[model samples]
Target: MDEKGGAIMLEELAFEIAKAAHAGQTDKAGLDYILHPLQVAAEMTTDEEKAVALLHDIIEDTDMTANELLAQGLPDNVVEAVEALTKKHNQNYAAYLAGVKKNRLATAVKLADLKHNSDLSRLEKITQKDRERAEKYRKAIEYLSK
Candidate 1:
């Protein structure tokens, strides 16, 4: 566990950016935002995984890009984990998903995030369009998991 784990991470500037970027999301399926990453980190049984959860969305969603973070000395692997979880806007989603399935860090983080999102839609209460969008991501996750 990190010396200040939850508190330190949540208070970090980058984490704050992610929090606000996803602020409107409540994960109504009863899973708390914090719990989602905690579960992913728990899957690896490591402190960094937990911390990674707090940061997975930082780069992709915030103004603080991955290069900037690396320059700040956040460590290569940590930066990799966050990047692994990020959605690539320009690349082929199919190829990206394929790449993730073969590597544990990217695969694990993506699956954990996907699984958490999937579990929340149990009742499946959303607009058809929204459901369709979620289904695409779900299919991608399922394909990667296999």
Candidate 2:
């Protein structure tokens, strides 16, 4: 566990954060929002990606700041990847989504996550526009992952 190149216990952390952030949140299909992050983490193959999965939405939706997350003892790379995926202050939602599409690590998680959300869950609770947005995100995920 103390190996220099080792990945830490990450899946559990990711799932915990997902559960907390998505608490009481249900998709249009009546599924819990926590499932989205879990699905994203499930797609990851590395510890770094797993850590990023756990924290992907924390900064955007919660009170957690990037600096605070950095102070929580996570590796710098994981923090960077998550920050790259996060949408910061921007007036254009489409542009913000476009930015995320260009990040490899974030796009990977986002693709898999959105795929599960829109495909598996059928977006039962989301609006038509939101569904369209999810579709756009899915397409971006595909392009980015490629």
Which candidate has the top score in lDDT? 2
Clashes within 3 Å, all models in order = 0, 8
Q: How accurate locally is residue 121 in candidate 1, as Cα lDDT from 0 to 100?
A: 50
Candidate 1 residue-wise lDDT at 42:
59
Clashing pairs in 2: 14-54, 27-125, 28-124, 28-125, 28-126, 29-123, 29-124, 29-125
Candidate 1 lDDT over 68-138, as tens digits, reads: 76775556776776777676889788877776666566676777777666653554566676677678779
What tens digits encode model 2's per-residue C-alpha lDDT throughout 83-134? 8777777647557656766666776766666666556346435577776877
Give model 1's TM-score versus the native structure: 0.64
The parts of candidate 1 lying over 4 Å away from their true place are 1-44, 120-125
Worst 10 residues of 2 by lDDT: 117-126
Candidate 1 achieves a global lDDT of 0.63
Which number leads on TM-score?
Answer: 2
